[model samples]
Target: MAKRSIYARELVNLMAGHWVARAVYAAARLGVADLLEAGPQHVEVLAKKANAHEGALYRLLRALASVGVFTETEPNTFSMTPKAELLCSDHPNSLRPLVLLWNELEYSAWDDIVHSIKTGECAFEYRTGSPFFDVLEKDMESARIFREAMAGASRLIPLAISEVYDFSGCNTIVDVGGSHGNLVSTILSTHPDLKGVIFDLPNVVESVKNKMGDEASRCEFAGGDFFESVPGGGDLYILSRIIHDWDDEHSIKILKNCRNAMGSDGKLLLVEIIIDTNNESSFGNWLDLHMLVMQGGSERTEAEYRRLLDAAGFELTRIIPTGQWQNIIEAVPASI
Candidate 1:
């Protein structure tokens, strides 16, 4: 019976995850969390403001309440929980963009996971008629949302990197494909002696410039294609969650670009999830499937990273584990 109960619990948990995602989507779409930012409100009042049915809204909130997303002080009144507060749009680490993107793009593509299993091709392009980046390029609104989502996801990475890695000896650090310069800002803020460069496409740099502010003076923004070239001469080139976005060929191109741009004494720091073959339950493995469905990339093992770095003319130096499940792979230019 214990075994049966465990199976039942797992089944319930899976269903609960779906329920939570749908609830989050509804809250995001209706701006419920944002509306409740001031205080709690009656269900009818919230329903009326959101143009939703009163009884349905109550039921929805009740479902979310059971999961601890919201709390019910009275029968039909709802208030935000610490968990639900993260959905608020104004929050610096808001999950709204993530919810929107996952539901809009990843969720639908995920429905065709069998397609990936059978053919080993991205379900996104198979379903959407274009690659993810290409689709984002054509749709400005989606592109902005995607960029914002990336920025939000990156909010913690810089701090994690700063805490885990030693940047004492480094002077100039280049953040390759650094979106919004958040990671660069975090690094520079931590290491007062380190001046940094945020390198990405022109549009990405433009979008982030205003946010950079005074740090903009210390940090240089270089707009160019990573495939074509990277700004040279930095002692450290940081690629945070960058390599997992491409296949080996393209990943090699970007790494080689960094390698070429590096000074003889330079190091390349790749901040990413390193998959362990021995681990059964790993987020990196799940993300590997996500990459297959969305971006056609794959999370790699440390050995794979070593091989890629070697091919790109870099010597794999050290792998430092961060506070999170991420690891920073430090590599240096191969001896001539």
Candidate 2:
């Protein structure tokens, strides 16, 4: 066999990943994984169920099968792979929403990446004439998908948090900017003795309340704005994946709210991805760019977190790794 050139092969593989992502996105949109859940199905049946063209659907399935997302069990028939299982909408760890969400949010924004890089402005905003979050607000469909996508992606984080952190001695946990109370619910479920407050916009508060059900017995839904103020009298405050959505000024403002809401000896725990200084292939590295393009925010290094927390009237205590994508950042009021 003729030896292939390693350099060209690697570069083409990199380019092929772009095609694979698009193929995966199409599969997700067409509900392919869910359709294949029972057993293997021929393209003719899948296309009809999915309201897609049979020939095109077959080609898409073939491409995905080559990459292990699905398997071409026999000619014209396909079955799900472990990778494809993540696309099943009913799966607890489903990434289908994320794929759909990327199609709505990131895919087009990524097309005009040059503009964001050139002007230091959000590509989503520049292209759509609205900020990323604003788009979520105006477009009801976008908002729902965004919520589901984030909730699905962070589903395990709550379990990780409950397991890794010691909740002893803390009576109340305030999940600032927490949506649907999943994290708060997990903590409250773990530490039955502790009470929880779900703080967010009025609409989100209602959603959280609706979702909490029996858990509401030990939880309070505080419907308000974090930019102005937060609910007080909490033993500990949790700001999970919140600070990274804003620039330093807004981040500090939210941190200060937590600081003000804190009692003496109160601690702040922020769930975020801690970025390292050195260059490496990391999710944080990819997210840093996503933050840059969608919002003017960036993932922070330890030094950056320390500085941000210090300016917000707290001292960075330590960072706890959950052996997952996110780490727990602990801080305390400086005076204490």
Candidate 3:
């Protein structure tokens, strides 16, 4: 017997990462975090309420406990760790929806990861026989979770972005493809004078229309396809986390529509993960693979974004880093 080298240990950790993700998804799907939110509970209690086998649940928790997601309080009792608390549905920055959404997306797609890489086709579409958005449209429950997931990921950015970028010049902010209106709500709340128009698919819009909170009075909701038209006459049109969900052809169509909707003074703000050429460890670089597997999109570099924007009749202004999960790429309609 011999001690394994650090490289081998690191590789092992990397290989076992998916096991952790799937296990977390199981806990989320079972509403385990919500059940444990009050306090510690016996495995039997969790299993009964979760409708899962008691013995299997215990084994799952024990393995998750080893990873600090749960703490074994006693022989068979457990409580959520700080990390696990994030999976609670009511947590302000809850990752529960993301966990659920990712699980739904990856359940089949990840199994076809090889096909995605070799064929340059979305693994999800390969297995499901429909595009991701179409599937979301058909399944109302999954659509709701997807909206929550996007807003949960985006809600933190508005706070960080407002501190760095001035929105005072912009009289109206049109949130294109805004899922839950969380981003626009935050922006309106922060800058009270600015009006917001949240646009998404009709079903999506209807679901999130009431989610705008105190700012609802100043906001309007519209439902339509961005490829056809965006809500016109907006000073700042935001395509937050939208471009990364489609290939260049579709993305350009959406951008061109936005460009057509804007006047010369209008600015287009794209919030997304910008992949870096230098770092293999970059989060965006890894997510680029996820876009390929799940959405048939790829995260882009600044240069790539510039090219894409230019093709759709816009000029890249400056990219602002919000010290969070994404950066804001601001562009204006290009001169004729």
Candidate 4:
């Protein structure tokens, strides 16, 4: 039987997301999941292969095993569980990038969560002494991880958005700040008639083009800062999880740029989590905090979205809930 003290201690232990982060990071850094793809091995063998200390690596594996990340076949041998396989870098739905990004950039920023709570300022800027995007632009490795994380997110979002929104009417779709063209690829794959353009910074565009290959041939790549201008002439403009990266003033400028580029008949879709006003349970609430701690942007409620749209000379037409946390907010150019 479980002891009372054991129950209390386990409850406290369950709340530490850091353990999961560290374990995942270790698996990523050591390529443990990749090694296990060939199958399981003894702790001594695995540790030597990964260049880790046997006893310490065993302890880490034991901790992860309890959470079902890996399975202990016997006393000192281990095998990959289903959960562990997701960490494999070559897995189509791999979470390696997500784990790495959180551990590297997000984790460091979170060290100053107290400052963010107190001053409502981004801990990222406070810690790094530069804006998040500026730092990303300067650092190549971090930028690659960021792009991969964004692409992973895009894969999930495409499944959600395709189900709720009809892209049948769209001839040309522009994915603003689209990283690696994942969203556009998903869209084009589903709707063959649609053509696309990926708009992002020049460095990002270069990276995306290299990754996209054949898809790059079909979709145009335009390198320009969204703060300055966006490529014109797409009937449907999609800003997927883009606005939340900036303050209200900057977000409005991006929306206004889309407004100017869009024709009267064109549609503007902002794919994002609409924060609930009633302070209820929400994924966006947690994400809002992360944005604050990491980037200084806050998620917005539907009313806040409406206000931003109005300021940008667009009328909020409809809010289509995707059942998932994200919603498709459709807007149109307002009459001057």
Give me the candidate number with maximum lDDT.
Answer: 3
TM-score of model 4 (CA atoms): 0.90
80-123 in candidate 3: lDDT tens per residue?
89999988999999999898888875567888889999999999
Better of 2 and 3 by lDDT: 3
Structure candidate 2, residue pairs in collision: none
Candidate 3 vs candidate 4, TM-score winner: 3
Query: Model 4: runs farther than 4 Å from truth?
Result: 1-11, 277-282
Candidate 4 at residue 72, lDDT? Answer: 93
* TM-score of every candidate relative to the true structure: 0.93, 0.95, 0.93, 0.90
Candidate 2 on 1-336: residue-level lDDT in tens? 335777778889987876888899999998999999999999999999999999999999998888899999899999989999999999998899989988767688887779978987777778878877767656667777877888888999999999999999999999998885789888888788999999987766765577675668999889888989999999899999999888899899999988888887899999999998887788898898888788767789999999999999999888999988899999999974
What CA RMSD would you report for each candidate? 2.0, 1.9, 1.9, 2.7
Model 3 residue-pair collision total: 0
Q: Estimate, for each residue in 89-129, the C-alpha lDDT of model 4 and write its tens digit.
A: 88887888888898877788998999989998899999989
**If both were scored by lDDT, which would come out higher, candidate 1 or candidate 3?**
3
TM-score of predicted model 1?
0.93
Candidate 3: residue pairs that collide = none
